[model samples]
Target: MEFSSWPQVPMINQKNYYTEFLKRDDQILALRLQQDERLNARKKAAVDIDRARAQAAQEGLPFLEPDPDLDEDEAMNDDDIDNYGSKTIVINVGSQNMRLGLATDALPKTVPMVIAKKAARSEAEDSEPRPKRVKLDEDAPSEEWFGEDFAREYNAMAQDFRTSRRGNKRRVLPNSRELVIKWNSTTPPERIPEHSDPLRIDWTELPANPAKAPDYIVGSAALRLPEKSKPRYQLYWPLRHGWLNEKEYDNRNMLERDFFLILEESIKNELGLTHKKDWNQYSCVFIVPDLYEKAFVTKVLDELIRDFGFQRVCFIQESLAATFGAGYGAACIIDMGAQKTSISCVEDGMVIEESRVNLKYGGYDVTETFAKMMLFDRLNYADFNLMRRHDFLLAEELKEGFTTMSDENITVQTYDFHLRASGQETRKYTFKIYDEGMLAPLGYFRPTIFDHSKKLIGRHKLIPRSVDLYNGHPNDPLSPAQLAVIAYVNQTIPSAVMPAPAKPARLMPTPMVSTPSKQRLLGLPAHLNGDKDATPLSSPAASPPAEDAGTPHPTGEDANGDEVGDLKGAQPDTEVMDRTVPIMPLEQAILTSIHHGSGADERRRREFMGSIMLIGGASKTPNLGPYLEMRLRAAVPQYPKEILVASPPRELDPAMLVWKGGSVFGKLRMTNDSWIGALEYDRLGARILNYKCLWHW
Candidate 1:
């Protein structure tokens, strides 16, 4: 996964030629030298300001004398002052349009307003001719366009047209006009007026002018395109801190109010303002940007609730929101969004916060890098004359579209623009490139740094540091790497090193006791020793006692002809009880066995468990559940019970799990004895947890 190769560009040959030309040409070199001199002069002027300040300070005088040319009154109030107001507004600026809305209003209405800038296109330039159906003979050449060749041709033409001067033209064709006629299905197709009938033609029935054209009629028709639905009102505000200035903020607020007023008017205009209508009752929710503090989220939530009368407020982390939006349960959310590249692990409807990693490498960085690379490459190709000649309008688009990894080949269209119309027509260029081996400046970190280290030392050693085994002199010790390797080898040594078979727990043999009275009573053999095995009848026996009373008896038989008891609780007729014996309990066996094993074995087991939890992000990876289950089974081979994994709750967004959990706790039904309020928070001074004050809100 390492990007060991450098990125390649095709225009290098042309760039080399231009670089050589710049070095050989005298006029261009002179111009470059003059520009360099101007830059140096500007730098010198910048240094003079600091030097003058230092001299003035040393002399104990004012830094600068007042300019005689400047007005005294104007000079007195040169600094700008920010005027803060209670009533402030924020506008939501989008790529397509800017939206202004109210902040304090309960049901804020957003209006789409454009900062209009006029752009002119020459009337003499040609436009793309409309795709018209040419009535050809049935046997016309039917060249079916498909695959790479067709795609290349199609893209090449589109690129040329887009880069050409004529591409900017706007035109109105006579057939552009559309008509809506009040005709039934019974009305014949011929009755629908064509271009022939000028008098009977209902001009008002024609659809209003096209968005780009106002005066010319393109066509007359009965069929009319459906009117586009108007944009709906929604509230949006900027996420950046202090993005709006005072005046702009004020203006935005005013515009927001106006937008609401306009909406009310529109409702009356179209649907009529009626008592039964619910148009005025609206609600807004904001998807605020991720700020790295809980207090900021709480502040925004409080503001929305208190000022805007919002009933329910929910907060979601941006990366989690993206993961939910993309519908991936267990994924590494690599969101290369604005401002930051946020990577998070989403698993089982919960986001592991510790696993989240954010880097400053994002779309903006990529665009800037590409722009710089292009500039540098351009310097090699052309002299300073053609620098900044092209607008590079598609820089962002091209970067995004081309920087994708896939099996399919990609065709990138590029254009070299001409500053002067007469210099050169925009040259259409095509680049056939593959994403393989492309060097993406992914932030400085190896994908598997920790993994590589683990492999270098065998048996997944957590702490493989070097140390002298015998407390010998420093010169006699092994190097750290060698010692780490040795430690790992020692850790992985097989049980065969000891070469001893596992010993089962030794059981103490029960003493065989017998007496003339007890022997006859228990139907025991007369050969049993009286002192060693004889016991009182009331004494508790380990095994079930045989039923015999006080009387001497021979080993041959009982009173009913049943055989007398054999040695070790066995009947004289059976050998099964004599051969079989119960082993030690499982728990005792395990503890004894492990205690007897090497001390390193116990330590290694503990370390492995610790490392299991340390790989928090990896826990969420696919197939990890079953993998862990298998490992646990192997570790505790005696336990044969089925393991169970409790399923996480449905409807819980993993990214917002913590926030949602907190919200649930906050909203829980609490008694007066357990509730905590703002008053208590204030009284407790935020450190009430130390005192264990369980106040109820």
Candidate 2:
């Protein structure tokens, strides 16, 4: 104030001034941080008191509101403090498996999300046992599902490729200069701890109850029922593609029963709950998929509270939970489970609404592929039927034990596994695999292997649809490719004239066939018939003159020589429209989710670029994180030159991430008010979850 008083200001240097200014700023920030820390400590103490009051009220104990005049810590009762949220539990449910444990536990129990029911033997089928087969239409229609003749073009391409590779199948160092000798010198591949247990729930482990055997079994034990006795039991996974397997178990009531029982039984057995009413003392933190149905989520909430009797419950997106568990502020989470791989961009404890993409394929697919490949190589286990639960478990065991991903290539090797079934002697089998082991898992990179045929050589209908996934809204359930196909069909309907097969020319957008994965997910039911007996769009006529070739549109000759292509009189074949739906592959799926993240906050994409976190059951495969990173980086040049992928630390299993994060979240004092208490649920019902959840429903 005195202009440095009588003391002259030191000779000011620009560099010194700048450094001194930064020093002052740092001091101010340091003071503010210390002040905040002191305030937070008091806030935490106050939160504890509030939570205690809320808990005491919920438990029907006398409680009083805090007196602001008194110190916050002194306002809490000692007994209330101990009883507040001490029995919180966390449950992370998945399509194939789920993890459940107390918030205080270091490890959670993992169980398969499957159940087996005692199937009724029908009178007709009981006397004459036979495999159920789908009857085909006597006269199948030959409609052009693709813009061009997909089968013909695909066959021609396959013929050319086969001819080129003929007679060159038996050569050493064939694929990538990797030798069989080098491969044999290394130790045998390690087996996953689970692979051994999934296929064999020893009879001794499952003791019969004196009260008569229950009508059903759950989890891994279901997969171990003796082959001869399997006909009496029907195994069903209540969840698929990360939701209730509605289509698989068409009966809603039965499916609901199985879904509820699988989860309830697992929780009761693992958490030491001998009685159903024990859930009243416990609260649950559930993890749901990124792309969940509104109705399904609400129903689950109602069941958790009303039927399961939880004191309170809360939901968090699986991707967001993984971020919390891994201690990352932002991440691109790739959840690879048995039935689907879901990718979502998470930032600052919330999942980006526009960055959720679920692809329906995962380790189970690779297992089936491994089974087919080994069988073709003539493995010793001759009667392997993937449809059977026991055989499916065996296939999964083999896949987990033997398969791996690599950037360089694969090596030839011989592997042996012991086949142990319930109530049967263990049998030994040996098989040699070259590219098969690697090839099967590599389906994540190469989508063609997932075709209906499963041979990986050709598609069922030879359809190849070019899909651009990032061009449309992420909120829409229909993919961008599906939307585009729909638009094309609508625009061309007025003048859809088919050209001759001999000289095909499209008057529509790019020629595309329905993608296999999405075709099943987004395609219409198979009941629609394209060969409807509707009249032609115009009267029948002979072939058009040569001048029609250059015209904007050309007419088609129906079976009766009528100018028709749109078949307007015939209702749209929803099945054909499904074929035009573009396919979604792992690589494209990751890119598409990230592309939607760059709208307002460019950092949504950039922050996640460095921390692409991989979790879920199938992500445990060695080198998967790195392999995915390489493929993603190579696929997109526009991304920053350096892209990295990270997995949970070694001590933490990827499969338990959701549960772990939920545990961490449950312990946070800030989340005390977020739980849906029974009182609130009784009034609001499932709607309470909409207000209590951590993220948007």
Candidate 3:
């Protein structure tokens, strides 16, 4: 969603604040660790008692009672405070990954925001039900998988299938029951099947309602599927381009429901909470992209407060939170995510709305580039159309590895691929990627090396001019470097000289356009309403795709199943193996932001350059720090060769930095002045956020 202008804090001695904040955080972490040890000890003691009782029952001997001092209930009650019951939790929902934790914890627990669906079992397990447990929601699907658990399982299954098959065909047993699937609709699954055997069937039509019986697996359990049963399953990326709105799903509403459920499941599992009711005791903060629509933010807030039972909930802009986490007051932030890269200038701890740039070029683009190089160039695998999720994942792994190496020439040979053609012979080949092949990911920085007919270079100007408001000609002229220093000082010192007052406010204000309630459900732009051919927001087929699925998609195929990967026969002479998309190099993005700041005050351009901070998952690319420093030195020859190109601490992952910032914000000591209590939210609704969060901008 859009970031509102935040209230500026008095410019303090930042060096002292940073040191004190770190010291307090370390103390909190140390206390948390102590609590964890106590909990573990209690658990171990309980397990020992259970074991002793079982032995006594078997041998017909008297069981020894547990020590009275070791009573768990008493021990828990005796503690000064229960950290587990604490309401302060921070959640960073990235386009590709999620990081979550209590405010006191030193680091957030992270998981890839990938969910894989598995085929539902025909029957539930026949076990004695606990009467105290809450009944399942009849309308909702009971079984689902999510996050790292799902990724692990899906990867294992894909790997097993690759290792078990010969000539892209599994050896079928004669007596095994055939499990053929009959489709209810004409549209085939996105993935074409490799085996025709019934046991390895694609999808079987079922009489069950689509909402009640989901078709796919969510967590790591999807990988445990029997080898013969693997073909029946098709992995669905609910979040394709970083949103939870997969338009490909046959039931779009069902997909959205699953997304929320998966998110809730992650929270519950991570916190070790047993019941949804327990959520009422906690206050939660969600950090999301600034590009999110108001409608999406409203929907999420409503769901979290009403359905999820959170005591209090708040939202923070990702980059702003990252600014806090990185301990920067005013710095240009380049958040390189999975499907999007956002560059924004923060002046006086506020995001420069006019300078914010979001581009659909990120880690996935790099993965796709590396994948194409491996398939079409390195291995010469002709059937590029056959590539699936696994191929790109392997490419991404290699891409990360290559980014770390200093060698000009590198070899990647472990991955093997089996290309299959229906009713034709299967060809198997292994990738032996060399230097040229490894150059694919370098496109992230050097887009000039790739085709530019699509104008991938200029889509989102990495360097944009400051809006007229930020521009101010000094009353007294000064040198460029001196001006830059003055600008830096002006930004840092709250008591700095103020600009001359503008005209008084008008008596009558312009009326604001209020969006219709119905129009707010779908997170679409308001401009769509006037377009004659604009897709209806209500159309299930036009629903947006989910955002944070980090998995790579099959590139050649279009949404309507068109084959667009014809390299030889296509009229264009240049056979660019991958799609062309604009990407602002991190170095270029920083310099442009600096230039914009320099326009406002020339002296602070160096300050901004010296405090360049990188956040987001893509920022984790090995050598990114050094590479950006080098590129910045080259881009602006006048700037000092030695400039700070900093990131979060080495122990703190860049991807989780925003979440850590949220954790800091959620702390009562930090956010007492800003938090909108649960009662306030209930009293004012989403409108309260605009006022309380200072999001009016």
Candidate 4:
């Protein structure tokens, strides 16, 4: 049943089955070409018009405007905005950048998703190293544990291993376990602490701590402030790791406000929009993450319509929108954003929910890793620290400029690059890299290279996904099936008599916190601990209504599902926190998503793999397209089928591909039904999205 290798029979390779595959492949190619041509219609028209104009100028003919019985009243206007789809605005906001423009426009204007606010002066922060090294534990092996005797035995026993499996290289073969097992050195640990000391910052002299500081500068302008003037302004990145940054604004209300203001200021500065009243004329098409939080979705809807006065709006999952833009019916969507990398198998126009996987490190992590690796190799930046805003920006520029994924053995060559900081003199650096360029990018596969992975290995800041919702959040309404199950438990089970249990750690809204009732599972010898020690999930009648009927909830939720006023010994969830934090590596995640999305249908899996369309900001890395295909093939040597990694046509930029698809979708007749009007939203509240979304949530 499993395909460890291709069909061995000669007939299978040469007969009617092989012939049919070739025919299908040809058809797929033809269809792809046709789709590309169709998407490039606007570009073709512009090119042809320019040619005609040049011809007319050479012939000394006046440029004539063709009058084709057009009516001025039919033209798109602000007053009749709803009547025309061309006026629809597409917005794709990421932690690093924001894309905004009309649906009909060829390209969306891109801007940094940053804000600068006036704040009172604060003391400058300085970097200091950790305490001196402590002695090894009593049971731990001495530093010279792996001595000559162990190496002799290991080397002698390894002679019988298969030649193909015996990879004796480390710099070239990254997966090889060969180590310099000697008297003094040591065998590398399986897992290591990911982060080093990131406490150093040159710009800590700036004013902050005031999340509500008056923000005026927006986008690229925020990063343009002079080094001297920066002391009076606080520059904040409102979004982080595909969500509202709680570091700057922990309060949910302030988080939304920061997001809204960032977008508002960006639109005003980029689109030249003057006031909030103007938003009513423009419908919004927001491209959200495929694995989005339900509460976050609702809050965004409220802000876009209730506050901004947008006439109507619709949401599109990034993976689905990517399919539309890429002109593919199915693909294992791998979006490598700045702060995170997400993988999902999108079939037709829908994303397979169970297969969605998000790795919390991406382009930003790579940039940081590249900097650290370079610093170790004598990268010429004086006291270079990522915490220093300029150094971080400079490193980002260098990462994209120097990093490459080509397999052709690169010669060690010295090169020079210029770092032109804002309001500062351009500094030049000369350096030579061996394999560090490729090694830094390899962190995508060997994730420990990204220092954030080990540090993020728990439920500290873990947010609940859509599937984890409604399991027990008081705000998340339960269905009749769940209520029936709970009622059965209460009626038959003796253990159900205790107070409510604490909510699951995965369901916790924010970072780990204690509930109103200090309910913990490890109650003092159960008999000694009375009912007052209960944590979550108490009774059937206690559960909220199945349908969220727009009922108001208290400011702070009762995580323990008990009375709000009972503030007894409410300890946090005691049911062992999950320490298994590292996400499945990129290759494994993609393969798993494909298998799940396709189920047992191998043909469907083949189709998805054949068209591994790459997108997102980080996806544009040089030679990344081909390198991903090679890696995928290497991961599955048993499958001989060609794994063709498709990319955007010359007419499309990967950065704007999703936005372009949103524009294309917004103009479709079927999309009209998906749009949620202001009145409909007010009546149904956030629950309206459950019905409006095109695919099963």
Best by lDDT: 2
Best by the TM-score measure: 2
What lDDT does the true structure give each of the candidates? 0.27, 0.58, 0.48, 0.57
Show model 3 residue runs off by greater than 4 Å. 1-85, 118-216, 219-231, 244-246, 249-252, 378-392, 404-431, 436-438, 447-583, 597-599
Pairwise TM-score winner, candidates 3 and 4: 4
lDDT of 1 by residue, 1-697 (tens): 6466777665667545644554542434333443454568557755876789889999998987546455323333413111111022222222112222232322223222211111132111112111111222223321221223323433343344234313335222222111101111112222222333332212213224334332211111101111120111112222211111121223544434332333333233323334323422322223323223322333444443444433333344443443443444443343333223333444444444323433222333334333322322221121211111122224444455444322122223233322211123322232222211111111111111001111111110111122123321111111111111112222232210122226521222222322113223212111111233432112112343354222221122221112223322322211111111111111211121122111224343232222221011111223333433443444344433532221124534322322222222222221112222233334443332222212110
TM-score of 3: 0.53
Local accuracy of candidate 3 as per-residue lDDT tens digits, 599-618: 43555666677777777777
Query: Could you give the C-alpha RMSD of every candidate to the true structure, in order shown?
Result: 37.0, 19.2, 23.0, 20.0
lDDT of 4 by residue, 1-697 (tens): 7576776654464434424553552344333443454458546656776898899999999987533343333333544444566658789988888888777777899988877666553111222211101222323332222233323323332232223223522224432222211211221112212232132223333345545434566777666554446445656776777766755554666666767888887777777777878889878888888766676777788989988889888998888888888787778778888887767788867787645656566888778766655544444442455544566577787888888776354335556665544444445555666555766776676554455422222222433333334333233322221122222223332232233336654444222332233442211111112344443233312234334323332121221233221122221222221222224346655664565455446688778888777788888878888877776777665555757776776657887888888887876642244677776677668766765777654
Q: Per lDDT, what order, best first?
A: 2, 4, 3, 1
Model 4 whole-model lDDT (C-alpha atoms) = 0.57
User: 42-69, model 2: which lDDT tens digit per residue?
Assistant: 7886888889988998999998766667
Model 4: lowest-lDDT 10 consecutive positions: 124-133
